[model samples]
Target: MSLFARLAFLMLCTVIPAFALASVAVAGSECPAVDANDTQARNSLMYYVCYHQSSPGEPAHTALNPAELPEHIKWTPSQGHELVFSQTRSVYWIRLNIRNNGSERRLWYLNLHYPLLDEVTFWRGDQPEDVLVTGDQHRFGSRLVDYRYFLLPITLNSGETRSITIRIHSSGALNIPLKLETPEEVIAESNHLAVTHGLFYGAILVLAIFNLLLFFSSGTTYYFYNALYMVAMGLFLFAMGGFANQYFWPENPKFANTSIPLTLALCALAMTFFGRSFLEVAAHTRADKTLKAILWICAGFTGLTLAIPYSQAILINTALGLVIIFILSIIAISRWQQGYQPAKWYVLAWAIMAVGALVYAAAAFGYLADFLARESLMQVAIGGQVILLNYAMVQRWRLLNDKLLEVEQKARNDLEYKVHERTAQLRSTMRELENANRKLATLSLNDSLTGLYNRRHMDNILPDLCAEARRTGRPLTIALLDADHFKAVNDTWGHGFGDTWLQLIADILTRHATRPRDTAVRFGGEEFALLLPSTDLEGAQKVCEAVLEEIRTTSVEAPGGAKARLTMSAGIATLLPNENQQEFFERADSALYEAKAQGRNQTVIADT
Candidate 1:
């Protein structure tokens, strides 16, 4: 048989016997019919006596009539033991035998208690042989389903007997007493197994709490769903009797029976919810709807099982349905892997959960028994599922964080690019503005017609030169020149030819005035001035003579295809320490009038 089938078989075998024992009843009349004094009175009334045999390879057996057995088969009851029988009793009594069949020596004990009477006792015997009584004496505690067997060993030889006696006393009446048998070794093994299972359960609980704290801190949907998932799975592990309760509530026998299936159902539901949210399934694809439907179906079936209690049938159907759903999940994962992005994590997580589920199912069904020290194979399955789901949650978080970083980086890069582009544009505009400003400055200070400094430029420089000459006690000269008969030339040759003649004279005067500090200006119509720094009247006269010679030699072309010769009359004046610019210019004007009177083609100097 498959592991799942074997597990189911074992579970049915174990659980059915418990149910039958719990339901057994005693006949009231049969209890009184047996002689209280006779040793066989209890045996005759006891319809069945079940016990673990001391020999290896012995199948569990029950005797219908213990009174007819040989001396070795019958065990003497303890003092004041009353075996009562009734048809309506709710508990059964049993005897178990323990033997040390291994090479190592071992200790054994029989544990039985009557909660109704508040009494507990232990029976110890030798290694060769013994018998033990283990049952509820007064119908207290939870109703006894079956007797437990314990193996307590200090030392024993191979094939030695580790046995004890158990006298079952009943408060309620029962006609036929049923027997429950289990090896002492099996019970000891179970306790140790419970301890290990409990530890694993604690681990899962811690993980759940950690994730929950993370959820509150981060406020992320992923952390919230992950926390829920871990809590659900943790509860499922606890319900399965893996961890804490084994040490604390081991006597609360109904915990695993009642809570295991319910927790599993709820866990599956929570996992479905977690998967949807973590994968962003609804936003990403229509497959989320299908998953929801599957979740609903599983939930519905689980609810039905809870609402209607039945023995084994409900459990079987639920398990089978879950198995089918798991198969479908596998197929869905294959399909999801083809194209869905979120499915990458969803499918991987489900795959691991699916395998864990299968292993759990196998153990639940009694298909494969656990050989481990502290837990059943099913508990291991639960632990595995918890780990895989946790890892998957982390993976989902990482994927989201990576995507967020990518978007932020892109935004930053785009912003930088725009800033750089704007900077380049601003630089281009600045260069254009600088060029225009330079041209404006040139136009403001230069004469357009004569290509010489304008009167405004000369007026601004002359004051600075005057101040410097007075401070340094240097000679400064100002010379005024006027083209003689310039108006008559314009009349004869047209104003255009007159303009050409004036341009020629301006060029000659500018070229002949050869000092860095000299100022040449277009003073007015047919009038010009040159200011010379660091020069006396004599130096000024020499500069004026050069100007007069150049002006006389230079010829201009008239607009009417005629040639014209130009000459200018010059007047020079020197500045004294006390002479102002107006006084100096008046003196130069008088000299220029003298030169014009003297026939206007020569230079003249002002009287010192």
Candidate 2:
């Protein structure tokens, strides 16, 4: 048989006999009655239980006429403990017959201790339409009584008998512990539970903060992982206890249902990594690989829970949790047996926690009886695990410190040699830094795409070049070249092709300005400038003509296998005596416009 099938078979084998004996009460017995004089809390009061699997939306009290109701025929007698349906998507209806046996009117509170249930609805058999609904699936304000657990007020007039039915449903394990109690009794129980939960949460917060501080001080990554694990565990407990629904997001039903599985999955994921770090299993290659696989599985489950339905998510997460617990326990034991001293405490700590978690899971799946308080049991187990882990960490600290002291003594003897080696390394680093700074300077001055001097570089060198030309009386020519119909080329072919055309133009310009004093500049988009220091206007025009001819002859392939030619317009100006940089550029710019005005793909020279 498969593992799940074998588990189911074992569960059936374990529960069938007990179920038979507990359910062997008088088949036709009416619901148990509560007396007016009874002041104590009644635990596990017997009631009739019926399945509402056929039509989940239909109430259990569907019979219109009072005489049509089949109280003893359809409903089975209770087993005198919490009802356990295991994990299911089915709705269950519980019937309780209450009578105010005494003369005076009686009032009592009905408490359902299972907080994770999605819905709990209460209604009188006579007035089924008038229902009071409350559960984790609904807003907290909708509860019949202002309490975390499902608390409903019941009033019976003197000498009156009323049949009450509760419809319950959940996506998780369904285990309902019913109790009839007085107001004082319910308040006392709530207070006690509140204090216990407060301490548990408070300890989790304190420990998480403490571990975070340790991580910061010691620079240990495992301490940070442990802190995350503790926080996730605390949140999972909060969700399981229904405090997330009650106190956190009271109005969001989706979040309330999602938090339980989501938090548990996250907790498991954190535990997986924390275990890897705590055990330092990397030295054992096989164990490290196994933990890596487990970590991925946990992560997958965490993500899957967010997208799947609550019913499937909870079932999968619970099963995954069991598997993880088993795997961690085995690894811890194996490491301990391998003479890893620190793993000794981990083995014992996780064993207690694994056993506690197993018992709780078994009870959830109906494989074990709900005799013990499962939540409290797991909390105690976690508390014990935390204490043991604290001691283990202390031992780890001492071990590391001892190693550090020995290393320090050896390091002192080699300090002088190490310092000389570091000095050599520093000199090499300074040389690399100088090279990097020179490269950065080159990058800042050049156009990124065209690999030519940019406008900023042109601005910096033009004034000095013009002053030298004026002092020596040797002519300096400035030529501006703009691609003809550049926008039309971009619109026709695309911007990518346009960028390639600009790079081709830049290459042509670089070829003509090959002399030591000649500089090529890509002033802006689709525009090129050549600064010729010892050349007059005529020499500059010949350079522009050569560039234009090369570009015109060159053919580029467009998107549709068509060859397209390139064309440009150029304007040349020779430095006039006493001409400023701006005037010199503007005269060239005007000549470039004149070239465009006369006709594109031609060069024009300014008046001397």
Give the candidate number with the greatest lDDT. 2
What does candidate 2's lDDT look like per residue over 1-608, in tens digits?
Answer: 23453354344333331242244435553555645345442543643333333234444345433344455444556655457765665666677776677787777887777777787778765565557877877888888776778887888788887777777767666777777787888889889988999999999899999999998876677788889988998998788777888889988988888988898898888888888888878665888888898888888888888898787776677767767767877888888888778888877888788777766666655555552387889899999988888788888777766765554332333243543555444322433544543465477878999999889878977887888888999989999999999998899999999998998888888888998668899988898899998997778888999999999899999889999887999999998988899999999999999999999899999876
- What is candidate 1's CA lDDT for residue 376? 49
The TM-scores of all predictions, comma-separated, are 0.40, 0.62
**Residue 3 alpha-carbon offset, candidate 1, angstroms:** 20
Candidate 2 error regions (>4 Å): 1-29, 39-41, 47-73, 125-130, 416-608
Q: Give candidate 1 regions above 4 Å deviation.
A: 1-195, 242-256, 283-286, 310-321, 324-328, 331-349, 371-376, 379-384, 409-608
Local distance difference test, each candidate: 0.53, 0.76
Q: For model 2, what is the error of residue 218's alpha carbon versus the real structure, in angstroms, after optimal superposition?
A: 1.6
